[model samples]
Target chain A: MKNIFYITILIFIISSCKKDGAVTNPSSVDQTYTPTPYFIQYPFYWSYYPVPIPTNNPLTVEGIALGRKLFYDPILSQNNTMSCATCHNISFGFTDNGKQFSNGLHGEIGKRNAMPIFNLGWYEKYGEINHRFFWDGGVPDIESQVFGPITNPIEMNENLFNVVSKLKSNPEYPSLFKKAFGKDTITSQLLAFAIAQFERTIISYGSKYDKGILSNFANFTQEEKDGMSIYTDIYKGDCWHCHTISSHFFTDFGFHNNGIQQTFSDSGLARITRDPADMGKFKTPSLRNLVFTAPYMHDGRFKTLEEVVEFYNSQAYLGANKDPFITSDKHEAGLNLSDYEKKSLVTFLKTLSDSSFINNPQFSKQ
Target chain B: MIAIKKSWYILMGFCLVILLYSVSCKKDSTNATPAPNPTPSSQKYSLSINITHFFGDSLFKYNTKFINAANDTIKFNKLAYYFSNLKLTKDDGSVYAPETYFLINFDNSSTAIFQIDNIPQGTYNKFSFFVGVDSLHNHSLAQTGALDPGYGMFWSWNVGYIFNRLKGNFGAANTALTLDVGGDANLMKYDLPTSIVLTSNKVVNLKMDIKEYFQNPYAYSLKTDDSSIHDLSAPGISKLVQNSKDMFSVTSVQ
Candidate 1:
């Protein structure tokens, strides 16, 4: 069995190299290509359940490397002007630097804020609904969601078939694809798989919060500790309902009708579900990188974390479709937090910032 | 060294054959018991769906004058919709549930026909079809072909497919409506449990009476002059739910 596997690998390498024009003679490319399997090392906080890997898109070093390259490559765009990195720069924790709505090709602004792509494999599936990506959760898994920005009129605006044609004709993409997927062909499915595989590896487990909570290695200051208590405590800040303390991925991945607006210009989750009740609802975003991914909300309505806290403290709108967690919080009167409590909460939210993730050499655009 | 390599090759080839065989064993949907007597099995039959659009008693044509129950004149160049969750039941209480979804434009030739193949030859009664994409598939994943977002059947902002798109002209003015009827499964489900039968050498024909949408329970009137809702949100969504039931009819089985 081992011999056969080795022989198959040898054949795959030789054929792929010949197809890629890397080798003129078959004998020159006969060495077997055995890829190092990449396993997702789960954070100690998530010790209960194992990280799930799709059988068809299992992570390998080659695939992750390819995805990282595709992520930063402008070739995926229509006019070669914008890449995934064009909006989600590594320095901003894979988000646009404080941009409300990201600027796409042709200087057109997008409707929703660019969500930081990290710890996506940890997205808690909301009951039967899979709100995999984006603000409205229109696309399901990462495999399907990857096509959205590329084709949106105000976004990248590139056609899917045209993008495939461009990648197929590209000089280097074919060989890179072969190394990642064990073939020289480039399809939309393979392209999405490569990108999604890379995204799953963008885990932010080395945060100060993680170290303090899991290993007891890092100690938080008094303000941060008070903030942490407010964030987790049900009686106080009431933030843990959407962003849990026990989990490394802060978000519960459920859509919530937060009291953002009384009358919404963006229908939000309701626009996707067509449910009147889902109006002004957006997916509960991860709190892990709140320091970087600002202004907040789907429309980038809030400019600062202080504003976000202030809104929750006093201005949480008592809309009909407001999430029960908030509405039931003394009938949508809000936490009515004191200035000190609000300040502590902001300080606690900052502890989630993982400088290690942003500066990870493996994740940066080379 | 050569002898060792040859033995390894033979063992590896055997393992490969086993792996291939194991894979092929897993994908059996129709598990019909084989006949005890050696005989050539009854050949499986194929089914295809044909949709014809009608405005009231008159067959709908591009730019042709058609009046509704409201006495409002409307002429449409294209009337398109999405339909899925086709289940065909046999006389013996056996059901064949096939995952087939289609987006059809009445004016276009390619979408006018839906070919469903590979069925055990028998008379089938009670064919059911949904007026929109099923709730299970609607939010499950991004899909291609008929359900593909690239087909413009998908909602760009939200996480659902635009189940129906009614575009083109009404009277002298252009009437375009992209009706995205999506909600919780219970609210959005427009299931039509059709009572029809198909026998040998016969194809099932479905006629979509577009005028019936404006009649009776769905008396929602529309004028060509009425601008597109732009955002096809609720209140209008209720109209679409009613339209789904009224639009479909099993015209013929022969």
Candidate 2:
């Protein structure tokens, strides 16, 4: 009887002590686990500026692979019918295939054109300000821009909470997330980080322009040579003002009202900024991949390079917020390029097309 | 042998009683109020702030009708805001700044109360916090916790946090009204006078009067003023932000 009593007392004491110790000891997160880092290779001309990989979310091979899988997965949509690739197809320079505006779920037509995706990592900054994303230049970074399409009512039309839950329940995704983010706990922030990492890798630098620069015009035809001269000539094409080619990315990454419309129907940047002075202003898109990314401008008004060149030649609306470069003393009315000059300019613009980037199997929906 | 056995039984009984008493004491300590006696300054305690919302003199309830200072009948569908960078001023002029960010939504009862732990025992007289995120974190990359974009407080298209959002309907026609106030320039800081004697664990009760947001320094009339305000440069946004700075007040400290 005495032994039984003592044993009971000892067991009670030991259990209580153990419970108290468990409660007091702080729970720890494993901080030693570090994933393998993946470095991006840039063209030699782009070395002047450092790549803006966020310190908190460094790129990894596992992360980029997981991001690629998520980009192609239809589970992110409401009815599991649409994915990022629905609008951003790889064959079309990561843009909707010859469509003016992308079609969303429920056959809803979007108000703006789907911008192409390429060389986004180099768009880290413009002048002193951090680079903005989307046609309106509203979002500050690519990571933040990921949330827009997924939650947009006309786009994916799905809740972020639902997407997280769906990803968590997937058998293959949990392990993939664990390998990339160090834990299986899926979060919207990590989702954005992964997608942004993959987007930063879809670079386009193997075009004829790039090759010609390296070889000092050895590969250029006579027509392409004259086209290049007219493209860079200050008094002729004058396209270098906003669509700067010297930077090699072929864009100044600035917002300007290029006189696309006379009346403020969509109100472009003014819708986000709420300033009338910024009325009708849209982001200056890069001039690369002109062959694949057709139906140009913010609203995708022009269908072909001939139409785009003709619009700039004679149909500039000359609105109040029209960029001074278009209304400058050199060509106040328009570029007024002749038929031969227009055809040559079109041929030269095609030199910016990189077939290797469009056909890269790594960017496909594997 | 009998006497030794009796003494052993007494000692064992005494130890069992001590064990039970100590366990009960540990449980009671968590539920108890602030200790009356002064504790050592080296010891740390947690400070909890319970936020109770109000509309004028009554407790604020969502989807309920209430008359505003403008005499317009209003019914709120949503009310959410962020509290960030909580700082406490000690009696010696020193500041105890806790890196805290909380997204308080009227629909979520769990987010109504937040605790600031690991605070050194001291007499604090002032409390200050920002109604919006700092410019550094606002424009920075993706974030988690309360600042996460998943919370719906963030403006993903514009790349900023909507500091405060009050969506509702008003008037005879039941017109929709959305007031999403956000911007780096409009981050309002409130420095409220407080008398908190923190010897042990303490809970400070704060009352947020929703009616004060429409009145106080600026009298906002839903009938006359622009009912929808999503842009940062909207006409009455500065007035609304100025009015919101005076909404929170410490009702009691325990």
Candidate 3:
């Protein structure tokens, strides 16, 4: 297999040239190993139907670096000071600065508004597939959705066996849980498969409008190319039939009722499928760092994107399971846009702000 | 000496072309595909399912049998519930469903036992699953498994989907039927659905005995901090069509 990947990159460039004292012969580290040709992969958002990594929790880079240090360690919470980045925040891009509600741990609050943990390992299943996961989708696997904010007594009240005995009384977490589970004994199903392998590496692709549409760069200027031809008109933003944007996480993850809320005091996705045609559905986030997440729906309550484009340009009263492309008037669900096309569609959604995925030093934690 | 014997015959013909390119990469590492069937068949088996708690079950506890308007018998202290949509039929109607299925949260002391281990050999029979939570995931939202409302099954200011969850304690007439069956938003838009089919494979190890279903002769039980055994957490329609006809049924797969 490409000479054992050039003898495992000549044993990690002869152990990084003997941890940098440079050149420690072994035939000059096998002539500076240049054998990078071997491809036989598969297992990155894996799915052929209801199956993805369950041969004893496969994916591991030391389990995404011990699930990115238990997702930025608030010591799995019970007032250790709240973590999963305090409702997912890698500088507003991982999301939460919008807050129509947030407060957890004693100050308590939280009814919704946190969404933005990026790509989510290419999502085949996890909420909106018959709703389940807060914002009332309820919950079901993304490793039991981080066990409802660690036993939520208003979120992160801890106790999955005392967060597996405070991750086996950490001393560098029992050799990083024995190098990601060869047995250091910290279960809760290996901390939900190392926080679902650091949330499938939170891949957002690298935006600036996806490298200016994959590369011809510097080209989008007629009002950000007519707001990307009116944001892919599936008849004026039938919004790609559930906020979709082609491939990997722009969101077709489903659930709607873009007419946010009206009357039904919180029956989102009709309270997890006892359907009245799913009164006030939700899930459809991901516009990809829509200029750093936002106070959008699911109760973050439109803090601005021009008040969610004037509430879809007044396609207003969407009660009773709306969405026939927001009651079809050729996708003009409310686009009366002319405040300079709402500042050129919020400057083409700030070219989908990557900012190196909010400064990714390999999704920093340490 | 003839230029050092022609440079040692070009370094012994470059070590015979690196030993014929390491024997043609050991014939392409013998074209893979080894490692399958990593031993696990020391013949040990036990698969059982038996959970029946019905006292008129729903329609607001239909047929009301956890008794005590002076009828007697209500002895439950805590009975854990939650069955998921699972199907494994194959008498040639071919079905194997597992988009996601989990049963046995019943006060999770390591999920009592809904055990399913590597079963591969061929078979011939039936096995359909889904005691509740289907209207495509019962009113969709806030779920974990057993439709989580922190596994109090779910109702939390009412949404729907909690099908038949029974809680405990009712002796000495204190009155506790805590039977949290499910539905509302008009029976999640009208009811009349219930399923459970079984006849399984890999040999007859399927025994579903919740003690022969509370020995039913119109027998169902309940009790737990009883204030008329407070129908678990208000499931309306007397606990959705009487706990979907008093908790599911389909015994005998010996």
Each predicted model: what fraction of the native A–B Cα contacts (within 8 Å) does it retain?
0.28, 0.51, 0.00
- Sorted on DockQ, highest at the top, how do the candidates line up? 2, 1, 3
TM-score of 3: 0.30
Against the native chain B, each candidate's TM-score is 0.72, 0.82, 0.31
Ten contiguous residues with the weakest lDDT in model 1 chain B: B23-32
lDDT of each: 0.72, 0.85, 0.57
Determine the iRMS, in angstroms, of model 3.
10.9
TM per prediction:
0.76, 0.87, 0.30
lDDT computed for candidate 1: 0.72
> Model 3's lDDT to the true fold?
0.57
lDDT of 3 by residue, B99-154 (tens): 54454543444224455543333332555564556665654333444454434454
Give Cα distance to truth, residue B109, candidate 1, Å: 1.1
Q: lDDT tens string, model 2, A1-366?
A: 677876776666666566455656667433455678999887888888567887877999989998899999889999999999999988889999989999889889998889999988766666214337888877878788888889888899888889999999998988888899898589998999899988988888889999998998789998899888889887788788888888888888778898888898878787777778889889888999999999899999899999998888888887699889877876676787888888898899999999999998878888
Give the TM-score comparing model 2 with the true structure, all chains together: 0.87
lDDT of 1 by residue, A3-27 (tens): 7776775565444334334444567
Question: Any residue pairs clashing in model 1, and if so which?
Answer: A138-B159
